[model samples]
Target chain A: MTVATSDRAPAPAAPDGASRPTPRAPRRRPRRGTVARYAVLCLMVVLLAGPLLWQLSLSLKGAGDTLYERPPRLIPTDPTLTNFTDVLDRVPVLRYVGNSALVALMAVVGNIVGATLAGYALARLRFRGRGIATGVFVAALLVPIETVIVSQFLVVRSLGLTDTLLGVVLPGAVAALNVLLMRNAFAGLPDELEEAAVIDGANAWQRFLRICVPQVTGVITVVAIFAFVGAWNDFLWPLIVLSSEESYTLTVGLNRLRGTFYDDPRLIAAGTVIALIPIITFFVLLQRFFFRGLESGGIKG
Target chain B: MSSSTDLAVRERAAAPRRPRAAGARATHRWRFVPWLMLLPGLAVVITFIVLPFGNTLRLAFTDATLLRPGRWVGLENFERLLGDDRFLTALLNSSLYVVCVVPFMMLLPLVLATLVSRPGRLMGFFRTSIYMPVVMSSVVVGLIWTSMLDRRGLVNETLATFGAIAEPVPFLTDRWLLLFSAMFVTVWMGLGYYMVIYLAALANIDGTLYDAAAMDGAGVVRTFLSVTMPGVRSTMALIGVLSSVAAFRVFGEVYVLTGGTGGVGGRNLTMTMLIQREGTGLQAQTGYAGAISLVMFVVLGALLVVQLWLQQREGRTR
Candidate 1:
């Protein structure tokens, strides 16, 4: 189907050329426009990525090199890995990364399992209070967590879960948005397939596990990425919850690093780069799924 | 629960394809299955979200603090807000932020989406690069921009080199310019994220409509105004509300940029920061913080209703 569409795309332009007063001149006009468009786009890319790249350059430069050199270069003249080594030496970078990973992984697992179950029930089953359940889920999206953070903290404290990773994971374990996305994904599946499984003596759990869940891998992937990234990038909650430096996630840890190394831009830059690498790698490796998920879930900025 | 199950049983019985004996047994067994599936999720929501929200309301009326037991004092916390200079400043700052930032958040993305909606070899790279900031931790964004906007940072250095100014501008220190600088960062971080949304909306538009408009001798601008704008009207409304709500809830950006001081001279102080201060500062006033949150909730809820109503009216008219 795509091939046929691509084949037909050039035909209209050919006929337009035939009808135009000067085919050669008209062709050049579009080519010029295309060039101009690309030029503008390239400029935008630099503008958008420039600061990060500049940080990256600063992160690589040796301590002796002047960071504020005139006609600032994005590529360090004398690059070294000492900044990275210094960051790792000064801070418990590995421990912080591990904490981030553990928290993110727990959130991912909880979101996938919990949201999938609820989403399946909402989409495919005749549930008691289904309307109310869905309404609560939708309303949860509108209640910004920050607004209720004070009480949420008190609750966590009451539960004896504060200063723990579990406390960090539990509140955001199953986002309403992820549940809704999973519901939509489940609803998009063909009912006939599920009905056939039902008629073949499959139980509800069997049907869900074998048929429905497999079909919504795309949504699952999307949910997993969102949950992981959210848990990882989160700063305010972890900052509020975790008191000891040993329990800090990468973001909170980086914030501490900033406070301590206020005068040392190179160390801070290195810490920033270290914090960014995992997520950037995740994005680059799963670029396709990331875009698909963002498109499907309509990610909030 | 029993009544609901009875309704479900009746709903199943009314269907034509079911074999009587097997269907009856199945219905009996599965009556509670959906609820079982929903149990874990509902438990979390009730415990974490619903209860805390209720507690926030309850705490707003009392003089609750970390140590002291609370006693009910109706409207006292809220009445104090009427005269609190810091709360008023935070409210005004948030209002100015939403007003100044939401339009650019909605429109800039539209412009970027239009530019890249056309197919090109580098379109994917451009989209990803622009979106890179959105995926990064806000901590990194705050840190990078804080350094860049410093008096001796790259921004001032570049301007100085270009002879645009004689001295460095204190982007973060100055009172008025601080909010605008924060808004600039907000717009930058959001541009690609919203652009992706607009692109998704644009892709759903039928290509034949543009062809039809062109056939009617409509120019590019005319086609865009008549076809493209209306096509993504719903998305525009969605982004408008989402961005505004997000702006109203702006905390992390301000918190990180100001080193948790809410910006120099409290210029960048937002409502969330104010709430954090009152709730968890050295002299914590939990009740006042709850009142602030409830007020924010009411304000945001009203804004949402108005926007959604406007969108619905627009939809019906179209």
Candidate 2:
């Protein structure tokens, strides 16, 4: 429907399917079919994002507001932050936040470093069992984590890492899919630059770190974002590994909030909203990179 | 993300063989460098995924508990599975999920992708907002729906207000309804994620095909059938495989909706839910869980193989 501006900006067939508008594309009325399309889009949005917004509205409602009125209120007439404060006071919201943040940070850094190094080596350097190494990662990719989870927990327990953040971050630290993505990114680059660097007496490490890594920073960002989101959003793994309340991530802690106080919808809404804040902010700021990296990476559909 | 993941491995499989013997970089000293660089990632993957899976297979044949590693029990656990009523319900629920969810996942996202294909601010807004649910934790998604589907909650209240129904629908308590509700949530969360993949695949579609369709006076429906369908056939098949496997192994939505008890009488339990319930915790009967996991692994593996075979067959038939 927004294709109304296609005349002015001339919508380029970007790899991401023309989502990003060309610069200075002035606003214009939608073409004929675009109107009906926009109506459908709006309805879909209401069906989709409407729930989250409703939750946000409920979170903002004050103690005076009756939650289940005959005609429900979409907006809080007297908006207040008491629900947020109430959830925070009731649970270790900050600790859970910090724990979730730490897990996300670790997963991001680990995937970027680990996936990048292995990806570069696999793509740029040839060695024994290269096919086997690639195969291993591919095989790992096929194994549903759900299937191996119990034994993974046993592995963690054996390593004395259960109930710890490290265990939660380990299995996903170097996700196989990210490694293959990085490998594909590295492989897509022309060999001329690395070949020149090699002839110039630059070692493999130098060629990789100085020449190759720079070209694939985009994929690295993609990996980081995926890892961060995966870690932040993960529920089952951390739930299985970490039993102690102190080690609980935001998702787990929020589930506790729901279990303990199912009556207080406002408080639960506030907790979920609090959990959503950092990730949404992060996504909004870096979504350009997120989609762009995805486009250039030519991620498998 | 899983839709992309299954395709990732398949693409790797089909990727052109890597050329070797590049330059001075192939020296003996550099021989170990690739291995060294690969060590950390490989170590993590092997330790956590590969080795544990091996242990799982081993444990599946044993009567291991959390405390003591018992001796081999061979087909005992598998035999127990035959009589386990919860296991049967879990299998049935998981099968129902795959049947209900996969087709919607394949078709809906492609439509969504086509709808927002053109570039503009509003389109981008739709894209980002639709994809937002994908980024959210399943727990958050589950909780949000749980609140909405409550007895006197948003859905029932709205329905009653509209004079649609007389009594509140038992979404959370009833077993069958809960499974269907979980399926709805699965499709809801998955739409934009697969829509993005469909967007990528849609972009790969040749524009000249659309032009050709138009030149022939092809209607919208005709154009879609002749142009878009063939173009994204493989992607659709890939989505079919990914969504089916994911649907079969569903855990988070059912877990959150049923509040970790797997619904009233645990009739809504999924394969993953069954594994989590039986395989984990202090009194964990890991042997039985391992048997359940082995079955899950094989079922999923068979799913992948069958889909791939079907895709290949369709290609040859075309």
lDDT score at residue A48, model 2, on the 0-100 scale: 94
Off by over 4 Å in 1: A1-29, A297-301, B1-30, B212-223, B281-283, B310-318
Per-residue lDDT of model 2, residues A73-157, tens digit only: 8988879999998888889999999999999999999999899999987886766678999999988988889889999999899
Tens-digit lDDT string for candidate 1 (B1-318): 222333333444457466323323334555678788887788888788888899899989999986665899999998999998889999999999899999998888887786677543345667888788888888888888887888777789899878888888988888787788888888888888888889999998887786677567665457668888889988898888889988888877777778878776676789988887788633668888999999998988887787779778878986
Measured by lDDT, the strongest candidate is 2
TM-score for every candidate vs. truth? 0.90, 0.90
Native-referenced DockQ of model 2: 0.40
lDDT per residue for candidate 2 within B147-226, as digits (tens), equals 89999778888988888999999998987889888999999999987888888889988777776776676655676688
C-alpha local distance difference test of each model: 0.79, 0.83
Q: Which residue pairs show collisions in model 2?
A: none
